[model samples]
Target: MDPLGDRVNRNGTPTVSDPSPGSEGGLALSGTRTLLLTTFTHVLVDGYGIGLSVLLALLFGRNGRFALVGLILSAYTLATAFAEPLWGRFSDATGRRGAVVGWGLVFASASFCAFGFVSPEGPWAGPLLILFALAAGAGAGTYHSVATALVNEVTSRENRGLVQGINNAGGSVGRTLFPLALAELAVVLGSPGWAVLPFAGAGVLLGLATVSAFPLASPRTFRAGTASPSPDGPMDRRFLARMVALSFLRTAFFVTAAGFLPTYLVAVRGLDERAMGTVMTLVMSTGILAQPLGGSLSDRLDRGRLLAGLLAGSGAAFAGSLLMEGLWSSVALLGISMFMVLMTFPLLFALMGDVVPGNRLGAATGLVTGAGGLAATLTQATVGVLAQRTSPVLVLLGLSALGVLSGWMAMGLRAPRSPGGRRALGS
Candidate 1:
């Protein structure tokens, strides 16, 4: 058999060579089990995290609300951005991915419950809310980086792409749906506070489950065997820089779209509130299918090229939105743009895993995520300023240009080769 394509056991199925520690009699559960547990946890935690965005409206006032929201959101983003690397490095040191995720969920959930007590009328309310945002953002940030590292750890490179796709889809579902669900609950419950209680409750329950999921301090997990050859070359600083640039571009695209799309729909397109909501929903929901499809393709194709192509597609779709007329045409173009953009996430993450050493997965993930967040924050602020000076359409066009530039950067990145001249596990 050609080892360069994929590693297979005697029966010709790809499986981890050795049984994970604690499996009964050397019988490890299939990667399916790994994907299920991790993905479930991801949905719950990420749902809760995204739900915080909804809470911002409930927690602040109409007067000075925009400024206050901006301040708190910036605090949250900064907290998450800075905390990712620290928690990632800590996970690498302890090799306790589950525990890290568990604690992160606990603290994040507690922050939600704390919000219930905050009186928006009181002077202390705004300060307390900012603090909560920071804490919640920190926890969610920690959970995100470590959990991704854990996913890469348990799956072979040959199968990692699909697993990441599934994993990303789960998180995207949580992020997209949770806020809408909360809005619906708010209508039925007649108070935003009552609506938010379920999120806190779910977080607590999920936190306990995370604790149980990691009974042993350490479990046997996917690791490169001694018989495997070393990476073809040392980590390249230039390659790292390329990744950071790509991440920045990706984040900028998302933040700008999310920040401005609603305004554009209402102001430029003459859409009513109902139509605007529908368009936004369609944009996010497209990712549920797009992510998995992209991941599956990444497994069979060159990841770098796939990412570049996706970015280029996203840019073209964004350009389409500029020229398209009528409601359906705009929706279709924007949806395609979202699909193309969101699909790049799993591919970019898988590429990062392939380029770095296994032991350093947590730190590497943290560095890129953190740096990307910071860069995106700066870029978004610049766009906000630009939007004030120019038209929203103009601002969006500039952001789309960034996407094309990012695709070019991705095109220049080297695909790391796995041992035996095959694709890297990250590929």
Candidate 2:
């Protein structure tokens, strides 16, 4: 009998298997414990790490200049985009994933706390804010890709999808709650910069503490059964290029549409700021759940086919939103589209994980994520310009076209073997 439970059947479900004594297959408790801890780490890192955007709003107050805000945000995002791949390569070379993550949190948290010290009255305020933004960006880059690789290392293939789903869900929770928490804290403190300091510091301390405990809790060695060493063990540059291209296109579609959705609703649907915010919230809330659902489904189904279907559905929904007349109809279609778009997050990365060698998971993740970020930045700018010169609907139609292209790319993805010598899907 196979010791790692059973061989996955045609439907991707495992059948019955007998395990030897002390086998890794029975260590579900330890694996799950590790997963939960990792998930919590993501919450702290991603939740507060993304607070720079919120911080920008607080810095400018009611008279926020779009150009200035965009400049600083662009710096932050680009810094993150550029740094991810480097961190991934560093982690792969050093084999000190925990140390990288712990130190990264420290750097990010310090950047957040530093925000409190930058006075609006000071002449150096803008420059100081930019410095902290870049620091935060670097920290964000370090945390996510390393954490993803760590999770992939610890979990078995049978459960990786579910666990990664949970991981993505944790990030969503952070993204949803952290900004609101920071905003409320700003109200109480009457200083936007100072408001996030306490929370950021607390997160830092907690993260460091968690890292300290990792040595005791983490698996002694990555289980050999989970992945096999690659035959050549060399990077597949062509596959990486394709992944980067596809990721860029998909991320561009999401970032452009989301960045402009509020404006579109206000201009086209005549909704006020508050109502638009409500609609936006409604759309984002669905994403929190959609990621996990998508991941779980990807694990059970063929990832390429599943991803293609999702993108196509999203495109169809997006097109419907453009054509729909009523506000409710538009909201329903757009919300569904947004949910499908967000769901692609885990599926795409997990697909990469399947193809990427275990030793280079970090680098692969970093490269794709960084490229995607850069694409999002460019796409947002392009969409903004187009909206100014043409119409919001026209820009969205273009985005829908990109979505279709992305789906085609996903459909063209080749099934690659895991490090454990397992095919991604049954033949």
Candidate 3:
């Protein structure tokens, strides 16, 4: 076999070596296990972290202070920004993303425990909450970056999109389940803090499960160029120009939905908790489902055009929310909007993976993820403030308009061409 040749291992029929990577072996049951485990880890971490916002709002607003909610939410994003790239960089440099993530799980578990132990009523709450946010953020951010990189390293582009989508969907599912569970838990126990225990316990189990899922991170090769970045390069020139804007627009549209959708359902439409949860679930559920389909579609279609359509669809979905008259109508709009966003995500990341080499992939993804998270944070704050000062309907509408604009622009994305195609790789 050629040193770089991809082949099926005798032990695992139907398995494909990632043709792009230098991995010696073929996929096996072990490979499938890795994928499932990593995806599950993503969902759990995301659920524990993102779902906290919903719980926080409930805890704080139940007492008549919804003002500080965005601050608390932003703290998590801030932690993600600071930690994600550092973790990714370290993983690449040391070739130990698994260890990094495993250690991160330890932190994630500790974060939840801290959240459980720290009381808003405690005089010591402020510092403890900060600690919790940092710990939680650190864990959540690493999961996506590491998982994405790991997936790309292990899978061929042929199915890479599907894998990324499944992993993302898992995270969305976690986000959906955990919050609703916490909401129910909060009600049943008659104390918001009581809602904390289940999530905290789950985090511990999840951390251990995640650590066990990954083998020790080892050097893997892929069909990437230099696995690093060069400012002087042509493809990177386009990527550099595109990354921030793409990340910003993606998050802006997403948070616009997240920030306002619940409020719209509950406030304007008068959906109860169960109903509200159902609506949120539907939107995210669609997004989760959309991931693999979208990725695979991108594999077959022009990715740039697909991204444009996804963004535009998201915008239109938000626009449709204004016209939604009942639960079913709201559900439809929510489903379509989220599907657009979720499907677009893995495709965009795949593009990044294609252009970025193994070494730079982690760093670039970390930065873009940070940019997206930052955008999500800002959009959330803006939407919340707007919801407070005016109407969620208006905010949703404005965001929808932006989505339309982004889609129009996305139509122009050409398949990323290196100034020199294969020759430019690894230069």
Candidate 4:
């Protein structure tokens, strides 16, 4: 029997095997524990990733150099894009998924903590910032593919969508809370640098905890039975291309809108740091509800059409937000846009799970997320440069237009057919 309880029949179809008598209950408990732990750690990893942007905005202040800050931010994203596939491949090969997750958290947290000690005005600041940011990004990049694959390995197909949604919701919670916590800390501590230390310290503590606990919960053992290739054969090249394109455009839209939101609120909207943080928290909080709901809906509806509608709705809402005169009204519209856009994340991931074989999931996920990270890097660089000459709001309007185009592209996507001659929930 395969270590993960999966096997291929003579007809080449993959099916899960039943656990040994009396072992089923233990397996279920183990899987649940793994899911919960992975989800919580996801909170730390994603929190550091998103919260870094807010920290940068706080450090630079409203009147600081936009282009330089953009380059610095781009370095972090570019490093992450470059490292994701490498980490994914490694995890897939070694089956050391827990090691990647645990160590990555530690390394990234330590790097960020080191960053807190560097004075912004010092001569060595630029080089040091880039170095630490790159380290942090690379470390943070290890979680998504490896951890998601770990979760998928243990979960049953019937509940996969809901499981992914729950995991993703944890990330959204992190994104929502971490920035607010940092902003509140800045207010109380009177310095962004000092504020970051405590947050990073928390990550270190969590990393240590994960490292200690994960080994007992998720064994590091790998056997030949678990090394079989996917029974579905190699993934279709055309499908890979389409998924990559969708991932790229979706990420470009998200990063352009949300990545720079703090700067946009502070520099463009003239909001104070606390108010900017609050608005950002509000915008990101929508994902907590949106992802799980979308996950449930995806299981019941046509995922392609649902994703298309959500993307289109996000574009329209974003455009409406730009036209609103009142700050709160604009915030309300932006929140709606965020809600719709965030829903698509789990849908896309679940779609990938539906089509890709379990053995190759890590590599495939790495590729898609790497593309998204690249898009974020490019979009951030462009937005930063453009903001120097024009209003950030104008650049955001352009992104909103692209979001609509992404929606049109999504309309053509279809889920793969199952052996029963019915379309699957995700393709």
Candidates' TM-scores? Answer: 0.82, 0.79, 0.82, 0.89
Q: Report, for every candidate in turn, its global Cα lDDT versus the true structure.
A: 0.68, 0.68, 0.65, 0.76
Query: How would you encode candidate 2's per-residue C-alpha lDDT over 48-167 as one tens digit per residue?
Result: 544555555455433424344455555666777888899988987766666677777777788777866677668988788778877877886786677777677666665556667788
Better candidate number, 1 or 4, judged by lDDT: 4
* Pairs of colliding residues, candidate 4: none
**Can you write out model 1's per-residue Cα lDDT over 126-240, one digit (the tens) per residue?**
7898898778778777766787877776555665676688888887777667656765676567666687687778777877777666533323233233122112346667877
Q: What does the lDDT read for residue 10 in candidate 4? A: 47
User: Model 4 segments beyond 4 Å from truth?
Assistant: 1-27, 214-231, 425-427
Candidate 2's TM-score reads: 0.79
lDDT of 4: 0.76
What overall lDDT, based on C-alpha atoms, would model 2 receive against the true structure? 0.68
Q: Which RMSD does model 4 reach against the true structure?
A: 4.8
Q: Which is the better candidate, 1 or 4, if ranked by TM-score?
A: 4
